[model samples]
Target: MTDSVFTRIVRREIPAAIVFEDEQVIAFMDAGQVNPGHVLVATKRQVETVMELAEAEAAHLFAVATRVAKVVQATFQPEGMTLLQTNKPAGWQTVPHVHVHVLPRYANDGAELVWPRKDPPLAELQALAARIVL
Candidate 1:
């Protein structure tokens, strides 16, 4: 199997343009950025997907993402911003590591975030929510 580039970054075996770091998470400049201040927030635990994250860990990851997004917004002054999380190949995730992409956007950037929106019936939604709720 191939080595995990993010794991190498975490282990300091490879260099990343790190922006922030704490015990739980790390934020770094995306090597292929959508915009100038684009950043990636990743869990330090080396989980492959969000489903493996504990509730507290997930919360902390998002908190750090939000903080980093705010700085990117302020510093870069993009017209808008996007918080992106992906799962596996079906979800457009290229890397195996669980990471959140903070994409800074601008006017006429030509990026597309199209997805189907299903407006299901209220009862169906409620039933699905019930099934999903823990």
Candidate 2:
């Protein structure tokens, strides 16, 4: 696969306002800022999605994200925050690289995450749950 925009940023081929970094993960300011302190935390390894991550790697990624969220909260003082991690295109993932958005939110920021409620019957939900192999 061709290098993603994030890959370039990781390689220093592109400039980014990075917030934190370690051997396993990197946290940086998001270019398309939903708020003043919106940040993106991603793995240093170029994996396309969360499922591609090993259990340890995925754990470390969120750990760093939690730390970054604290920093954003202290600095930006936003009313609320959203830690968004999307998957494929159908899941609102525009970027293929696995990352989590540490977004600072305020009242009526205009960002909407709307979806229809399914509200399946209890028996139907139980049947769906029974199909899972996990």
Candidate 3:
């Protein structure tokens, strides 16, 4: 994989509001604001999606995400926080590179995530769970 916008920022090839960085991952403020303290955690490598990341690389990315969540939680003092990661265009992943969105949430803040609830039959749900190896 070639360098992504995030990879460039990690390498200091582009200017970013970088909050934290290590050899494996980089955390920075989002260029666009979903919330006041929205942050993006991205891998230093150029893997395009979470599925593309090696196991070790994925672990490193999540570790950075966890740290960024703590910082955002403490500094912003939001009512809640959301960790979001989208994979591929079908999942609303705009960037080709893998990144996680650390969003600060508050009541009446208009950040709504709606999921249609369908109570699948108990047997179906059990079958699905059984199929999941993890």
Candidate 4:
């Protein structure tokens, strides 16, 4: 299996501001931050998307993400928090590696994600869903 940047980071092949790490997961600061204390939590293996992760791996990643989120929340003291994970490129995923983005939100913070609402026909939606079957 080909290794992702996250995998390299986990193996110390690449540098990352690691905040937490375990056998299954690693949490680190995002090199590009959308908000203060933004953290990226990813699995050690080279899973490219959430749909590609095993159930046990998914659970472990979330558990680690929660732990890291707590630290980020405490450090930033934002109004609320947002936990985001993107899948394919169409889902706004820049990296091929699976990762969870922990974003701290503030009351007046201008950070917002806007997507044009498009309600495709039911037939098209069904066809797309069918094609995505693992």
Which runs of model 3 end up more than 4 angstroms from their true locations?
1-3
Candidate 3 RMSD to the correct structure:
1.7
lDDT of 1 at 92: 90
lDDT of each: 0.91, 0.94, 0.88, 0.88
Ranking by lDDT: 2, 1, 3, 4
Q: Flag regions of model 2 displaced more than 4 Å.
A: none
Q: Which candidate is the best by lDDT?
A: 2
- Model 1 regions lying over 4 Å from their true place: 1-3
Question: TM per model?
Answer: 0.90, 0.97, 0.89, 0.81
lDDT of 1 by residue, 11-107 (tens): 8998999999999998999999878998999988787889999999999999999999999998999999999999989999898888999999988
Return the candidate ranking by TM-score, descending: 2, 1, 3, 4
- Candidate 2 structure lDDT: 0.94
Clashes of 2: 0
Q: Model 4: clashing residue pairs?
A: none
Best by TM-score: 2
Better of 3 and 4 by TM-score: 3
- Tell me the RMSD of model 2 versus the true structure: 0.8
